[model samples]
Target chain A: MDLRAKLALLADAAKYDASCASSGTEKRDSRAGGLGSTEGMGICHAYAPDGRCVSLLKVLLTNSCIFDCAYCINRKSSDVRRARFTVEELVRLTLAFYRRNYIEGLFLSSGIIRSSDYTMEQLIRVARTLREEHGFLGYIHLKTIPDAAPELLAEAGRWADRLSINIELPQVRSLKELAPEKDLAGIHGAMGNLSGHIAEAKEARRTPTRAAPPRFAPAGQSTQMIVGADDSDDRHILGTSDALYKKFGLKRVYYSGFSPIPDASAKLPPAPPPLLREHRLYQADWLLRFYGFETQEILAGGEGGMLDLELDPKLAWALKHRALFPLDLNRASREALLRIPGLGARNVDRILAARRYSSVRLADLARLRVPLKKVSPFILAPDHRPARGQLDSAGLRRQLLAPSAFAQAAKPRQLALDV
Target chain B: MYSVTLESPADFAGWREAARGLLGAGIPPEAVSWHSPAEPAGLFAGPPPPDVPAQSAIPPVPRDFLEMAERAARHSDPERFALLYGLLWDARRAPGLLRTPTEPRMARLEAMARAVKRDAHKMHAFLRFREIDTPEGPRSVAWFEPEHHIVEAEAGFFQRRFAALRWSILTPRRCAHWDGAEIRFAEGARRADAPADDAAEDLWRTYFASIFNPARLKPDAMRAEMPKKYWKNLPEARIIPALMQGASGRVRAMLGQEPASQPQPPGPRRRRKD
Candidate 1:
């Protein structure tokens, strides 16, 4: 097939894996030789119709697979048109796109073609050519084949900024029933090996006895778990994520809501999960990572095991535990203030600083552009008293759930939120 | 009031020197009027303010304040200089003033710095380079219109990132060029100077259209991140409207289409048997 035809097929095949992050890699630039730079913040050059950031040239090497994972779009059994890009073609595409500032770099994944090691070797070769041949100093993310040889996995790490292995299903039973070819233990084993190497490389870089530290996936490893694909609820999915994070020291755990594909298998769900569920999961994930919320705390914010679709997880937690509301803004600690509905981490820091000089008032939060209505009932400022026990009202959740307020709050940075 | 003229729009060094002179001279922020060379001089414009030496005895501001002032200098706000200097002047009197977000002058200065930083970030994100074949070799060129006086301040980012390739980024206010080794600045150039498109754009547009999941179309979300203002220069943006128009139909077709025949069990060579 022609290059355009191949790209269309491959990108379509790869779209289901929603891991487009190109950040947290070691900062490198082309000043010395190559053709890119990554300084901390990953830039989203474009946004796709799905509200996903087009940061990297997220595509697969080929849509041909040996394994028949039922939920995957590129399963070998599926009759969708398949295409593969030669290594040279892949390299050229990356450079061409990089030259045009269309992407951060290449995010190359391939369905298991030939064998696991062989597919991994091909993925590594693309990265090697970019870094070694062309001296390209851009961000690269490689989806690792779990069963690939350890030496090949190590080599893959040397050339790429981040490496990932998909734990496709949350439950072992689901994996066995739907994707029999996948091994949960094998995936975990690879993740364990990667975590060790990543930690060692970081240590080497820190206490360098030699010229420079040997790089091994400097951005670390991440994994994706498909939501709404099986019988897994939010509790089970988050539990899996929490375990992976603790055990493997992962950089991120992406939650991709199962969307309908053109040639989906009979085994998959009839409809995708509500997109808001995916959004809520991301919010919960943030709370877990940044806001110091435990897994239990976040799960408590949800009903049974599912997150509340209407309210944000943080707000849900605050509403459920109304005793925590009306925390004195001036007297509250950073941790206490962080639990406030409208307060983001940035605003909390600002409040801490602003309060050091004088007592923080409602107008002060307004200047920081805090969502006043969402926060007003939960915080007690010098001039604001939450309408004298507003938190005690039974209709408080409904009052805060006003559609106009939610719309205004959600509109500003909804597109920028990434999983 | 003293009329101080800065060397350039994003001239943090010049602003720092002038601010030091004013501060050392005990001149209040209200007593000074700041202007860059880009601004038209009034008929009654006074002579440029006297410069202060580096060793001038101004009260020491916190390191964070100095850094924030540096960023705020790149803001397009005409009052940016005054705002920063006013904050600096306030910092000397009020202990822990820089930490106070509620302080009016400090908050405004922080806001200005944040805006300038955000503008620089957007420039980093949105600048789309088109390949142009020069006599020497292939050179990548991009045309960007930034919302702030950030072209010079943000040039180092491009220089560091695209140092290997020969590239030029032309903006309305100024232009930056990198030729593998050294980065040079020149006067602003017209948009016509940069190439409009590259050969790979068609393939890129193809990838963009295919990767977009029609089942989860959120044009509002897409527009929020890749704002409409940037759509003109983006190669893939031309297809967005058509894609949006065709999304519902495409999704309906997918939902309506019969499920594909499930693939048979794993092949004989596969490690794990289904």
Candidate 2:
């Protein structure tokens, strides 16, 4: 098949992975001896119809697979047309795209073909050739085969800026039932080894006495968990993510809702992917990482372990814990200010600085571009105070709720990682 | 009242020198009018700004205020210089005036600086380079229209990033170029000067189409980031309307297709002891 046809099929297969980030890596440019540059902030060269940023040239080496995971489009039983790109073709394509500023770099993943080690070797070779031969100084993210040998995994890390291994399913029992071939223990074991190497490499680079240590995925590792493919609740999914972040120090845990595939398995659920559920999960994830909210606290904001579709996780939490509302804008600690619904970290810092000079008032909040309507009932400024028991008013929730399009529960057209 | 005429639209140096001189001469911000060449000249404009002494004493302001002033100077607002000078004059008496956004002068300056920063960031994200072959080697050229006078200020970013590549960025206001060694500036040129198409764009369009999941179309969100003004220059943007038009039918087709189970190859199940 032609390259275009192969790209169409392969990129279609790869779209389900849902991670296109090219950020937070060591800064490097092409002036020295390479063909590209990455200066911290990832650039989205274009936006897809799905509203997701197109940062990298994400594709698979091939869509043909040996393992028949039920939710996957490229499962061995799925009768989709398959194609593979020659290693040289992929490298040439990446360079061509990079030269025209179409992408930051390449994000390459592959379905298991022949064996785990062989598939991994092919993936590593593409990255190695890009770095060694062409002197490409761009971001590369390789999907590591969880069952591959440790030495091969190490080599994969050395070549790429970021490495990932998808958890696939949130629960181990779900994995056992649907993807019989996947071993959760094996996946965790590989992640444990990667975490050790990544940590050690970082320490070695920091030590002044140590010679320049080799880089090992400076952007760190992230994973994707397929949501709505099985009987997994938001609580269960977040619990899994929490454990992964603690155990492996994951940079990100992407939640890809299971969109309907053309040739889906008979046993798989015939439901559309829960796009809003995925979005709510992301909001909760941000709260977990940035807002210092624990998993239990976030889940408490939801009903029956499902997030409120109408309200964001932060606002929902504030509504559920009404006693925590009406925080003093002038005297509240930075942590307390962060819990306010309309206050982001940036705005909170501004409030902290502004309050240092003088007591902040409602007019000051307006000038700072804080969402006055959403925050008024929750905060007490110098010149403004909420009415008695305003937080406890029955109509407060109605007033706080914004008009959300996803509240109507439309079946999303496709699964994307925008959230 | 003193009148100051700046050399260019984004003349931070000229603005800074004039501000320092006016402050040293004890001229209040309300007693001055600032003009740039890009703006219309007043009928009875005052003479050029008076020079400051070589060892003139300029009062120290907060570091953050200086940074904000530097960015706000690049704004298209003709009054940005006067605003910063006014704030500087007021800040001498009210030492902490810059810290609070409650002050209207400080708030307006902050807003203008944020606008300029966003414009620079958009330039970084939306610049699309098309390949153009030259006698020296392959060069890349892009055409961009910025909302602020940021072309000269943002040139260092491209220089440090794409240092090895020979490229030129053309805008209606000004243009910048890098010849693999040093950076240069040239007069602005028309869009017709740029090559209309590149051979690689077809494959890029294919990738864009294939990667997009038709089931989840959010054209508004896409427009919010990429914006309609930038669509004309983007190669893949030509297909966006058609893609949106056909998204629903495509999703329906995928949903209606019957499950086609292929024969399973020899896989991991047999090897695993489950």
Candidate 3:
């Protein structure tokens, strides 16, 4: 097939692995000698209609696989047209797209072709060529084959800015039922090895040494778990993510709501999960990582194991624990202030700074653009306080709930990441 | 009242020099008026700002205030200069004035600075280059329209990223060019100066169309980040309307079909290296 046709097939095959991050890497520029640059922040060059950031040229090497796993479009049983790109062709396409400012860099993955070791070598060759031959200094994210040789895995890390291996399903039972070829233990073993290398490289850079510390995936590794593909509850999903963060030191755990694909397997659910579920998972993940909330504390805000679709995870948690309301804005500790519904980390810092000069009041909150109607009931300020018994009233949740677009219609709406 | 005319609309250095003279002379902000070249002179324009005595000592402003003022000065707001000077004048009496973000005037200045920063970031993300044959070699060129005076400030980003390629970025207010060795600035040019199309954009559009999942269509989210203002110049944007129009049909096709039975694993799942 021609290059354009191949790109269409490969990109379509790769779209199911929803990760487009290009940030949190060592800073480099082309001023000294190279063709591209990467600041600390990742830039989204475009937004696809799926409401996803097109930060990288995400594509696969080939769509032909030796193994057959359900919930995948490129499984051996599926009759989709197959295609692959030569190493040189893939490298040229990356440079062309990078030069036109269409993408940050290449996010290369592939089906299990020939063998795991052979597949990994092909993926590494593309990255090594970009770094050594072209002097390209942009971001690169490689999908490491979990069963590849340790030597090949180490070589892959030297060239890639980040590495990833998808867990695919949250529960071990679900993984076995849907994708029999994937082993949970094997995936964790590979992640453990990668974590050691990343940590060792980081520690080496910290200490005094003349030679440059051995580079090994400076941006670290992340994983993705497909939601709605199996019968896994939010509690189970979050429990798995918490373990992954603590055990593997993952940078991110992307929750991709299973979407319909052509010729899908009968083992998976017929209908896709609500997009809001995916969005709520992201918010809860943020709270777990940045907002100092335990997984059980967040899960307590909802019935069963699922998050409340009508409200964000943070607001739900606050409504559940009403005894913590009406904290004094002027004298409250930073941790206490962070529990308020409408305050973000940045705004919390701003409030702390502003209060040092004078007492914070209702008018001051308005200048900072804090949602007064939402936060007033939770905070005690000089000029504003919740009415007597207002926080204890049963109708408070009804009053604070905005008209949800997701609740109004079955049609898909925007899934924003903000809390 | 003292009237001060700056060198240009986004001239932070000129504004700083003028403000320092007035501050050292003990002039109040209400008695001084600021003007950029774009604004017409007021009907009873006062004399130039008074000079400061060499012996007068000016209080040291916070480093954050200077950084914020430099960014805020690039905003298109006509009163930005006066607002910045007002805060700088107030800083003398209250050393913590700038730190109090809840203050109204300080909040306004901070909003202006945030707007300029967002504009610069969008410029860095949305600018696209197309290749054209030149007498020297193949050169890449792009056309952009910025909402603020950020072309000069953002030029270094392009120079550092594309240091090896000869490229030119033309905007309505200013243009920047890099020829592998150094960067040069020139006057504004029309859109006609830039190439209208490139051969690679077709492949890019195809990749864009295929990567988007139709079942999760959310045009509002896409428009929020990549707005309608940027659609005209983006090659992939031309196909967005068609993509959105056809999304429901494609989704219906997927949902309407019967689920296929799971495929059995092929012989010997793992193929050892020969």
Candidate 4:
């Protein structure tokens, strides 16, 4: 196929991976002699109609895989159109797109063509060429093959800013049932190996080194799990994510709502994308990372191991634990202040800073643009207090669900909740 | 009241120099009126204040206040300089006024600085560089319209990122040019001066269209980040309407099609060493 057709096919095949991060990499600039630079913040050069950031040129080297995973559109049994780009074609395409400011860098992945080792070598060749031949210093994320040799994995890390190995399913039983080829132990083993190298490199940088610390995926590793594909609850999914964060020191864990695809396998029926569930999962994930919330505490706010569809994870948690209400805004610790609904970390810091000089009040919160209607009942300020029985009223949850225009239009079921 | 006219709309340095003289002269914020070139002088415009030596030492303010004031001064609001000066005056008296983010005056300044920062970030993300052949080799030119006076402030970002190439970013208010070595500021030019399109955009549009999944259409989220104001300049935005219109039908077709039976197992091609 030609370049345009190849890009179209490969990018379409790669769209399900759901990772476009280009941030958190070591800073580099082209002034010293290169073609690009990466500060801390990743810029979304464009947003696709899918509402996803197009930070990097995310495409697979080929869509021809040897394994037949059921949920995947590019399974061996599927009759989808297949295409592959030659190493030169891929390299030239990346440089062209980067020069035009169309993308931050390339995110290269490939299906098992000849073998795991061979596929990895092809990916490495593309990255090595980009770094050595062209001096391209932009962000590069490589999808490392799980079963590839440790030596090959090390080489991949040297040239990449970030590396990833997808743990496609949350539970190993489902992974075995759906994808017979993938092994959970193998995926974790690869992640463990990468984490060790990343940690070692970070430690080396801290101490004085004669030569610059050997670069090995300075941005660290991340992975994706396909939600709604298996019978895994939110508790199970979060438990797996917590383990990955603690054990592997992952930078991110993407939860992609399984969407319908053409030429689908007969084993699993197609369904509409669980967009709201995916959004709630992200909110809960944020609380786990930044808000000092434990997984069990977040899960306790939900029913049947699933997050409430109408309320955000934080509000749900706050509603469930009504005893924690009326926390003093002026004197609450940062950790306690973070648990209050509608108060983001930034605004919490502002409250902490402002309270040091003067007593914080409801008016001050309003001036900071905090949602007073949502936070007032949960917080106690000098000028504001929950009315008698207001916090204990059974209708409080219903009152707090302020159906936004977008939410009302997107979810017709929200109207049914009123009845 | 003393009237002071700044050299330009985004002249933070001039405003600072004048404010320092006024503050050292013990002039309160209400007694002095600030004006930029864009803002016409009122009927009661007074003569420029006379230079006065410091009667007493000007109290020290936090470094954060200076940084915030510098950014807020680039805002298009005519009262930005006066507001910043008022904040500075209050900060000198209260000592900790700048740290109180909830204070109304400090909050307003912070909001203006945040807007300026967002405008600069949008310019960095949305500016599309189109290539044009030059005698030197190839030069990339981009036409962007920023909401604030951030072209000069944000030029270093593009220079550091694209230092190897000769490029020019042209906005309506100001322009920045980088010639592989040094960055130069020039008078702004009309949008027609930049190239209309680049040959590489066809593949880019294709990739943008193909990467989107019809089942997960969320145009509102896309618009929230990439607003409609930027659509006209982006090459791929031309296909957005068509894509959104055709998304439902495409999804219907995918769901309506009968599931394909599993393909017969192929003969083993190669044996694994493990």
What lDDT is reached at residue B204 by model 3?
94
lDDT of 3 by residue, A268-332 (tens): 88888877777778778888887889999999988899988777778889999999888999999
Query: Model 1 over residues B1-274: C-alpha lDDT tens digits?
Result: 7888888988899888888888877788888888887764577677666655667677667788888889988888888888888877876887687777677777788888888887887888889888878999988899999888888888898888777678899998999898877778998889898887678888889989988987777776676567789888788999998998897777767876643222111111111100
Best by DockQ: 1
DockQ values, each candidate? 0.36, 0.33, 0.36, 0.35
What local lDDT score does residue A44 receive in model 1, on the 0 to 100 scale?
84
Residue A1's C-alpha lDDT in candidate 4?
A: 72
Residues A309-398 of candidate 2 have per-residue lDDT tens digits of 777778888999998779999999998988998787778888888888888888988888777887899988878899887789998988
lDDT of 4 by residue, B120-150 (tens): 8788788889999998999999999998888
Candidate 2 ranges with C-alpha deviation above 4 Å: A405-419, B40-43, B257-274
Candidate 4: Cα lDDT at A217: 94
lDDT of 3: 0.85
DockQ of 3: 0.36
> What lDDT score goes with residue A294 in model 3?
96
Residue-wise lDDT of candidate 3 within B60-145, one digit each (tens)? 87788789989999998888989988888888889889888899998999899999998888888889999999899999999999
Candidate 3 colliding pairs: none
- List model 4's recovered fraction of native interface contacts, to 2 decimals: 0.63
Q: What is the lDDT of residue A2 in candidate 2?
A: 99
Candidate 4, chain A: TM-score against the reference: 0.96
Question: Which is superior by DockQ, 2 or 4?
Answer: 4
TM-score for the A chain of candidate 1? 0.96
